[model samples]
Target: MTDDVTAAPRIVVGVDGSDPSKAALWWAVREAGLIGGVVEAVAVWEYPTAWYGWTPPQAEVFDYEKNARRTLVESIDRAIGPDRPVEIHTRVVQGHPAAVLLDAARGARLLVVGNRGHGGFAQALLGSVGQHCAQHASCPVVIVRGPGEASND
Candidate 1:
């Protein structure tokens, strides 16, 4: 929320290619349009920590960053479409989802995230990433619910 005339305000959003994330991206875009700001759609990826005995060689390792980028783009396309009303930036980072989002929201006008993501607890109202960002983001935060997401049930 700077007064600098040259740079448009920035609204950072966390996208994980999940339905909830898609809704969060859509809401971020519309909010940016309302404030004449730009959207930063961020997707974070990290190596799987569950594998202990079987480790893939570097040659056989999966391209997580590339897949993350593709997923982010696909989510954007599905959520906001090709015809964007406001400027949208996509960033793929390698780190914890909540930490990455909190860092990205630095100096931003606002931070947006989904109520839930691809977590093990399917019935949870808020996922860890969203909850962490809500508690730690330097700027204001918005947690958006995906289509047909129920509450008070």
Candidate 2:
């Protein structure tokens, strides 16, 4: 018999502790459960570019990644809840959100993200990261808008 378990689809979802991101994770998990797939939750972070041409202290950089991992873990727990329905994985990376998600989505069955993230211009229909992934991801992309999220368009 073929090892079907090894071929299970992997859905990569970008989560940033936002309500919309949580909604995306919820949707991805539900879809994965239905398709007998796996969910990969990705969280990306980077030092502010304001400190251009200068790197932060090693401890500071390490602390940022440490905190990012912690937040990603908490976000996954809160989004998936106690009763996990599908096998889920978490990834924490340091880079632009769109770039990080795009890289993580390589070989993934699907790429999922929130319609809008914790970025400027909340009134826009799709946040920069979501829009970029939708246009450039190798796999299909799903943009989940949180409840009550209205758009100017």
Instruction: Give the top-scoring candidate (lDDT).
Output: 1
Q: Give the TM-score of candidate 1.
A: 0.90
Model 1 C-alpha lDDT per residue in residues 43-140, reported as the tens digit of each score? 99987764784545675768899999999999999999889999998899999899999999999999999998886588888888888888998999
lDDT of 2 by residue, 1-153 (tens): 566547899999998888899999999999999999999999898875436657645643356688878877888889888899999988889999999999999989999999998886877778999989999999999999987776558
- Local distance difference test values of all predictions, in order: 0.91, 0.89
lDDT of 1 at 41: 97
For model 1, where is the 10-residue window of minimal lDDT?
50-59
Candidate 2's C-alpha lDDT?
0.89
